[model samples]
Target: MIEVQGLTKQYRSVRAVDDLSFEVKPGKVTGFLGPNGAGKSTTMRMIVGLDEPTAGSALIHGTPYSKLKNPLRTIGCLLDAKAVHPNRSAAAHLKWMAQSNGIATSRVKEVLELVGLSDVAKKKAGGFSLGMGQRLGLASALLGDPEILILDEPVNGLDPEGIRWVRSLVRALAAEGRSVLISSHLLSEMALTADHLVVIGRGKLIADQPTYEFVKEHSASNVLVRTDFVPEFSQALENENVEFTSTHDEEGREQLLIRDQTTDYVGNLAYSVGVPLTELTLKRASLEDAFMDLTSDSVQYHAEALPGEDSDAS
Candidate 1:
């Protein structure tokens, strides 16, 4: 397990990370999330001893990273896919890292094949595409067979197939009792890959919970109902003190967006009031929705609305 306790970083007048605390447990994939400039990269740097924290500490299995004799064997991280030497072959890069960590040279071939880079192991890293570079970085992370993995935007340039492979690989590692902490802007994939989430805003911890619970709590889930007798249903809903919004569909059919109520409650209420319903469906919020809603205040950059677009949405 990896533990971050009261971790903090200061750059002149700005505080990049502010006393952040969390744990990445074994046998689970924990997603690290935040908006741009939310100190995600800074925090990860402090965790791996890349940057000195102004205060607090990050520990891997009870030992700080700086104190570890073989840090790579305890924690594997891919913070930057392009941090490799441009002139070196893919296999050569892995070999250097393996030698530095006293890892077996045979393991380089194994990891190259594992990340599907054996075919291009002799290619210079400078000529590799973005996706291939990412694969090489991943190979480096796995070279030590570390118990913990920290990957930042691992799927940044991957195609659909490569993205799916990453998802499966991380899950398989976690299944084998490894601790994985991944950071990505791909909310849909994060929702599928992460068992837990650590969301931060303005360098402070905003949420630390299971993926499902985080989405369910941060985003609104409503039951949308369409009915011919919209007037009666609206009145019934108001009488029950249930919260809802009213809108018209594309077909001009009136619908009620009932909140804090389940489909059964809406369906039963409609039946009791003799209202005929055309449609009743539950619309749960996705991980992207939850992330946007929760991080609205913490977003560092905001785009202006396009012409004829709603400013509120922008």
Candidate 2:
């Protein structure tokens, strides 16, 4: 298990991570989510003792990373896939890491097969594709068969098959009672893989909860309805105190967006008002939508488009 308390990091005059506190428990995949400059990488660096924290502490199994005996065997990390030497073969890289940490050389081949990199183990890492490099990095991290795995963008350049493989691997590792903490910008992927989430914005914690609970609390639920009688529908909805917005369809029929109600309630209201409903459905917001809503203001870059502007105008 990993426990972070009052973690803070500052570079020059700017704060990168601010008073962050959270815990990653065993037997679960905890996703670390944030925008581009939200200090997620900084926090991960601090956890592994790659970067020093200005205040607070990050402990792995109740010991600081620098003070841990056999640190690599306790906490394995893939902070940067490109941190390896370009001239070395994948096997040579893992062999040296195993030697440095007194791990068995046979573990290198084991991790290679585990990550599906055995076929390319003899080839120089410089010639490998980004996806292949990621696999090699993962192989190195698993060399010690550590109890904790901290990966940053592990699936960034992987193809669909590779992505699925990583997801399954993470899940399988956690099922063995290992703690897995993954940092990624892919909300859809994280939603599928992570059991819990820790979201931060501008170096501050915005949410820390289960994946389902986070979505439920931050996303808005709405009802969608389609009808031909636009005037009657509006009047009925207004009378029932249902706030709605209308948009015309290709067939000139009206589609309403109803707020503060469920689809069943809207359907019953339409039935009571003698209006035939073509469609009545509930629209539950997705994790991507929730992420955008939560971090919209904290985004470092914003795209600008004027009203009625063409795509090429900007």
Candidate 3:
């Protein structure tokens, strides 16, 4: 497990990370989420000893990364996929990392194949596309066979196929009981990939919970109902004094947005009143929705909305 206690970082007057605390446990893929300049990179840097924390500490297992004799074996991180020498081949790059960590040179071939880069192992990293470079970086991280993996935007430049590949790889790693911490902006993929989430904003912990629980907590309980018998259905709802708002969908169908309501209740009500229904959909809150709602106040920066767009969305 990776443990952080009161992890804090300061740059003059700005507290990049402020008394942040969390745990990335083994046997699960945990997602790290935060907006730009929310101290995510700063915190990760602190964990890997690339940057000094103004206060508190981060532990890989029982020791700080700086104090570890074989740090690569304990934690594998891919903060930047293109941070390697541009002139080196994929195999040669992994070889150097393996040598530095005293790992077996033979493992380079194994990891290259693991990341599906064996066919292009001899290609110079400078010429490799972003997706290929990401694979090479992943190969280096896996070369050490570390117990913990921290990846930042592993799917940054990947196509649909590459995205799915990374998802499966991370899940496989977690299934083997490795602690995996991933950070990415792809909310839909994160929802599919991570077992849990660690969300932060403005250097403070906003939420830390299971994936489903976090989503369910902030999800809007809106039951959208559409029917050709709009007047009859609206009358039934009105007779029972059910709280709902009316709106038209993109297709010009009348839709009732009911809050604090369940599909069962709406369906049963319509059925009892003999109002035929065409569609009943319970719009569950997505990870993106929860992230935005929870971190609204903690956001340090804001984007101006286009004319006629909802300015209150952020």
Candidate 4:
């Protein structure tokens, strides 16, 4: 298990990580989530000893990262897939890492096969595609056959198949009683891969809970209603003090997105008020929608449309 207690990092006046505390239990995948500049990478760096924490501690199996005699055998990480030498072959790269960490050279081949890079084992790291590079990085992480794995953006450039592979691999690893802490912005994939989440914002802990629980707490499911007597239904909703937003469908039909009310309630209300209802549906909050809502204010970076992104009809 990985435990971070009051992990804090300060760089001059800016606090990169606040007094954050959370535990990644064994046999589960804990997703680390935050917006850009939210101090997620900084916290991960501190956890693995890449950066010094101003205060608090990070422990793996009750021991600090620096205190581990055989660090690789205890923890494996892929914080930066591109940190390897560009000139070296994938095999050569893993071989050197294994040598440095006292891992067997035979284990390097095993990991290469595990990550499906055995076919391109001889290719230079620089020539590999982003997906291939990510695979190679994963190979290095598994070199030690550690019980703990920490991966950041493991599927950054992966295809659909590769993403599925990674998801299955992580779940299988956790099933074997290993601890997995993954950090990624791919909410849909993260929702499928991780059993739990550790959400941070502005360097502070925002949420730490199970996947569905977090969504249930941070997002609400709404009811969508469509009616032909739009003004009549609108007046009825207003009379009943029901909150709803109006939008137009592709066919120019008016639609009402009703919040804090169930479809049955809205449908019955329309029926009682003689409002001809064309449709009524429930729209549950997805993991992506919940993530956007929870971290909306925590987002520090915003960008406008790029060149040619907005084309004028005129």
Candidate 5:
């Protein structure tokens, strides 16, 4: 398990990670989510002791990472896949790491096979592709068979098959009772892989909840209804305090947005009011939509219109 309590990191006058606190338990995959420049990398660095926290602490299995004996044996992390020496072969890289920490050379080959890099273990890492580099990094992290795994953008440049492989590997690690904390900007991918989510914005914690609970609370699952009786449907919806948005249909019918709670209620209301319903479709917000709505204001960059496309120029 990993626990971050009141963690804060400051570089000069700017705070990169505010007082953030959260826990990543074993047997589950927890996704760390945030927009760009939201202190995610800084926070991960602090957790692994690469960057010291200005205040508070991060603990792996109840012990501070800095205080751990043979820290890599307790908590394996892949903060940067490109941190390896380019000239060294993947096998040689792991060999040096194992020798430095007194781990057997046999473990190096074990992890290489585990990460599916056994075929090119002797190839120089500089010539490897991004996906191959990521696999090598993962193999190094698993070298010690640690209890916890922390990965930052592990699938950043991976192809579809490589992405699937990483996802399955992380899930399998958690299933074996190891703690896994993965940070990514892809909400849809997280929705498919993570059981819980920790969201941050501007270095502050925005949400820490189960994946299902977060979506259920923040995403609106509404149904769209279209009918010809505009006046009657509008009156009925208003009387029932149902929140809705209106648009005109091609046939001049009224289109109504009905919240989940009022889906059946509105259908009954339309029938009682003698209004014929032409269409009713349920629309549930996806993880991507929920993430956008939550972090819209926290986005660091906004796209502007092209030079010829102005509001008044058109």
Candidate 6:
């Protein structure tokens, strides 16, 4: 297990990570999330001893990372896939890491196979594509068969198949009672892969909870209905004190977005009001929705919306 308490990092006048406290527990995949410039990378660096924290501590199995006698056997990380030497072959890279960590040379081959890089073991890392480099980095992370894993954008530049493979691999490792912490911008895949989430914004802790609970609390599911009697239905909804908004599609047909009500309730109300419905479906909120809602203010970079487009549009 990895425990962080009151962790902080200050660069001159800016605080990169401020009193961040969270735990990566065994038998589960904990997703570390934050917007750009939110200090996620800084916090991870402090946790792994890459950077000195200004305050507090990050402990792996009750020991600080710098104090670990066999760091690789206890924790493995892939913070940067391109950190390896450009001239080294995949096999040579893993072999050296294994030697440094007192791991068997045979284990290097095992991890290379596990990450599907055995076929390219003899190839220079500099020649590998982005996806192949990511695979090689994963192979090094697994070289020691560590009990804890920290992966930053492990699936970055991977194809759909490689993404799925990584999802399965981390989940399987967690199921074996190892702790896994992954940080990525892929919200959809994180929703599928992570059992829990640690959300931070602007170097402050925002949320720590189960994946389902986090989504349920931060996002709202709404019922969308399209009807012939738009006027009547709108009036009925107002009379029933149902919160709703009206919007038009590209073809200019009106639709009602009813919040705080289920599809069944909306359908029954439409039926009672003699409204003929063309569509009634629940629009469930995804992890992307929740992330956007929760971290809107924490995002340091903002992209201008297109003309006629609003943040709340649809």
Query: Which residue pairs clash in candidate 5?
Result: none
TM-score, cand. 4 vs. native: 0.91
Instruction: Provide the overall lDDT of each model, using Cα atoms, as 2-decimal numbers.
Output: 0.93, 0.90, 0.91, 0.90, 0.87, 0.93
Runs of candidate 6 with Cα error greater than 4 angstroms are 311-314
Q: Using TM-score, give the best candidate's number.
A: 6
Model 2 ranges off by over 4 Å: 248-253, 306-314
Compute the lDDT for candidate 3. Answer: 0.91
* Residue 17 C-alpha lDDT in model 1: 93
Model 2: ten consecutive residues of lowest lDDT: 305-314
Count clashes in each candidate, considering only residues at least 3 apart in sequence or on different chains: 0, 0, 0, 0, 0, 0
- Record all residue pairs in model 4 with backbone atoms less than 3 Å apart, i.e. clashing: none
Cα lDDT tens digits, model 2, 238-310, are 8877788997667877688887688888888889989998888898877887787787777776678788665
Report the lDDT tens digits of candidate 6 across residue range 1-314: 99999999999999999999999999999999999999888888888999999999999999999999779999999999999899999999999999998998999889888999888999899999999999998988888899999999999999999999999999999999999999999999999999999999999999999999999999999999998888999999999999999998889988989997898899888889889899999999889999999999888888878787895522
TM-score for candidate 1, residues paired by index = 0.96
Clashing pairs in 3: none
Model 1, which residues run further than 4 Å from truth? 307-310
TM-score of each: 0.96, 0.94, 0.96, 0.91, 0.88, 0.97
lDDT of 1 at 95: 95
Which regions of candidate 5 deviate over 4 angstroms? 227-232, 247-254, 260-263, 274-278, 305-314
lDDT of 5 at 27: 98
lDDT of 3 by residue, 1-314 (tens): 99999999999999999999999999999999988888888889899999999999999897999898777888999989989899999989989888998899999999999999999999899999999989988887788899999998999888999999999999999999999999998999999999999999999998899999999897667899988888888888889888889999888878888877889999999999998888899987799988888887887889998887788776
